[model samples]
Target: MRRRNRSTDRWRLADDAGSAAIEFIFAGLILLVPVVYLVVALGQIQGQALGVEAGARHIARTVAAASGTADADARADAVLDTVVEEYGLDRSRVELSIACAETAASCPAAGATLTVTVRTAVSLPLVPPVLGLDRLAVVPVEASAVQKVSRFWRDG
Candidate 1:
């Protein structure tokens, strides 16, 4: 068999010139875009989770340490507001619930265990507002904290 000429083969290869670069860019975008978006979404979720957890814990502590039910309510509201602002959470979306371990008529009673729960949804970054996509593409985050009120606690 006769050997083929290298020059002819080189010309044939020219048809695919720059194909590797194009393929690389296409594949990289296809893979890297999702990865980058996942990272951003996870970061947002984690931040919101931490914020919720902090809010619950702090509110529980504040309520447990308050002098009376009215004081506890005020302190909890203040802490929740601060936490929402600091964490960039939507105040309108945030939900808070407070309960006590004991079946006492009044929550946060003296020597009772106070439980506080904070819940919210984290909207994914770059989500479009159209078609309610922003609302649908959200991760729910919830946190709860429990603290014991002082046995000597008294309401004024």
Candidate 2:
């Protein structure tokens, strides 16, 4: 009887030893998956932010280099279209606003400041529309740039 009880206790201890390892594996998986997902999401958003910043600078420079108001507007639109295509962003979701610190009807005036703003929203992956987190899941990114028209620029 004493030998049988000792053997039973040893088997029980062996079984319990493996339970901790199994639990540890499950806990690690549960923590790791969400962290990986968050990292991927953040990387994508950072890329979009960089694209927007570059686009704003390009648009401002393009407008400042134009010869006239009409030319500036056309060039700005073209640059914006290129940015949308290059960044793979939705046209309707992206908002562009331009403001001229000086005369609005002129392109290259001396000391004129051309400001360009780009705004877009990035939607997080695997975000469900429940728990009132839908709005929180969408991140808004904005970039602005200002360029001055050269003093040597001549209006046509």
Candidate 3:
């Protein structure tokens, strides 16, 4: 009877020996998944923000340097497209707005202040497209840049 009791005690201890490892794994997973998702979501938002900022800054410069309205529009479009592609931004989601401080009936007029704004909404990773949840889960990012048109600009 004593031997049997000892055997039961050993069995109970053995049963608990590997439980720490199991608990560790379970706890690690519970904490790791959310953290990893947060990192990925933040990365997406940051990348989009950088892309928008670059687009705005480059487009402002391009427009400010242009010779005329047509040239400015063309250059701005080109810069925006390049930045969108380079930054993996959704072209359909991007919005660009340009404003000038001078009201001489000419945007980006010589010595005028050019302000360019870029906007977009970033969607979280792994969001299911069901019930419009994917659309609802978005973070809006916007960036703006200002540049002064060259005073010696020519109207071509």
Candidate 4:
């Protein structure tokens, strides 16, 4: 005679109902991977922005130190390279654009300002490919750094 097996409490036991919860748990983890990747990408952008700004400040400081007659463009480029490297960016992907104001209204009354813009194309290796975001190819990341000339560099 088989005893009634109450040990298998059908109501409280795991059943088809729990299957959906299990699927949800797995799917949630899959979805969270992309979200976390995007957050990391944003952080990288922020870091690059700070690096560009620091480069600009360095350029401005260095240029202001030399005679106003010097060719600051080269020095500025070097400073930008160092800054990009410091920020852990690929030198090839990193692009820098600089502007030098020559007119009194633009550059006078204060030391020269160095505006350094750095941009790179960043791609999410694991997440984007799975989400069909690969069609976009690459996302452009941009940052700008501004540095003012020191008081000493100003023309009295």
Candidate 5:
């Protein structure tokens, strides 16, 4: 066989045409996919957080506006149901708690503070349930709101 020209061999080795574009595309994908997934997860969590906050506020207001304790409890439950539906949250994963600040013996007295807490779990998109890691794939969001009973309000 004839000997290859050293200059042509060197030129072939130095040829880098189209390599930069390919490298850039690979690097971009490596950096972009995780960033996009993170943004989507955060957005979903934020929406659920906002929904929980709004639901707490609605529950507190509804409870405070009720004419009686029984009415308040019923109305609060109804509002919670509506919020669960509106937010598209799994009812089994959502929890609501109502308490009277500084008093646990009875219903809130006039001018007493009523606190409503809403909690829910938001599952991350594209995450599959892993053995012993199911809870890690979900984010928990909670919100609380307080409303004071009107001074003229009478307990039922």
Candidate 6:
């Protein structure tokens, strides 16, 4: 009987079989961390924008309430402060510009336009409170609102 070539026919696990694929899965998460971070960061930016726009709309209403002429710039600034203070946003991050146009029926000018801007540095979410390495997203966001200054009065 021929002797079995046990040494030549032995089966052994190779280190390379599907090892690369397993490694890829782990590495993929490392690469994906940044992308996930960016997605979350964007949500914070959107929140900031919405907050500013809401603040602007409220300011317009305030202007309409005053019987006297409203200092558009001052009003805009004040509104920003009120809204951002609670959210830890800096007033300086916001920009306020107003235009006054003569109206047909004693309107508070044509309208008051307010723009609020927040750079990533200022508006980064407090939840993370640190920089992320995954997706390097550092961008500013802006929100704007224009309100028609109608006859000023609040009878209720």
Most accurate candidate by TM-score? 1
Screening candidate 2 with a backbone cut-off below 3 angstroms (N, C-alpha, C), the clashing residue pairs are: none
Better of 3 and 5 by lDDT: 3
TM-score order, best first, reads: 1, 3, 5, 2, 4, 6
Query: How well does each candidate superpose onto the true structure, as a TM-score?
Result: 0.89, 0.78, 0.88, 0.59, 0.84, 0.56
Q: How many angstroms is residue 88 displaced in model 2 relative to the true structure, after the best TM-score fit?
A: 1.7
The residue-by-residue lDDT of candidate 6 on 59-126, one tens digit each, is 66666544445464456567667888855555666655444444334335434332233232334443
- The alpha-carbon lDDT assigned to residue 80 of candidate 5 equals 84
Error of 6 at 41 (Å): 2.2
Estimate candidate 3's RMSD in Å. Answer: 3.5
Task: Report the lDDT of model 6 for residue 43.
Answer: 77
Kindly indicate the candidate among 1 and 5 with the higher TM-score.
1
RMSD for all candidates, in order, please: 1.9, 4.1, 3.5, 6.0, 4.8, 7.0
Q: What's the best-to-worst order under lDDT? A: 1, 3, 5, 2, 4, 6
Which stretch of 10 consecutive residues in model 6 shows the poorest summed lDDT? Answer: 112-121
Which residues of candidate 3, in runs, are more than 4 Å off?
Answer: 1-15
CA lDDT, candidate 6, residue 76 = 53
Error of 2 at 115 (Å): 1.5
Model 5 shows how many backbone clashes? 0
Two-way TM-score contest, 3 vs 4, winner: 3
Tens digits of per-residue lDDT, candidate 4, 1-156, equal 878767686655656666888899999999998898778878876776676567656765666554443445567677877877788766777776655454555342246665556677655445456566774666677766566655454343
Give the local distance difference test score of model 6: 0.56
Model 2: weakest 10-residue lDDT segment is: 102-111
lDDT score, candidate 4: 0.63
**Distance from true position, residue 26, model 4, in Å?**
1.8
**lDDT (C-alpha, whole model) for all candidates:** 0.93, 0.83, 0.91, 0.63, 0.86, 0.56
The best candidate by lDDT is 1
User: If both were scored by lDDT, which would come out higher, candidate 4 or candidate 5?
Assistant: 5
Comparing 3 and 6 on TM-score, the stronger one: 3
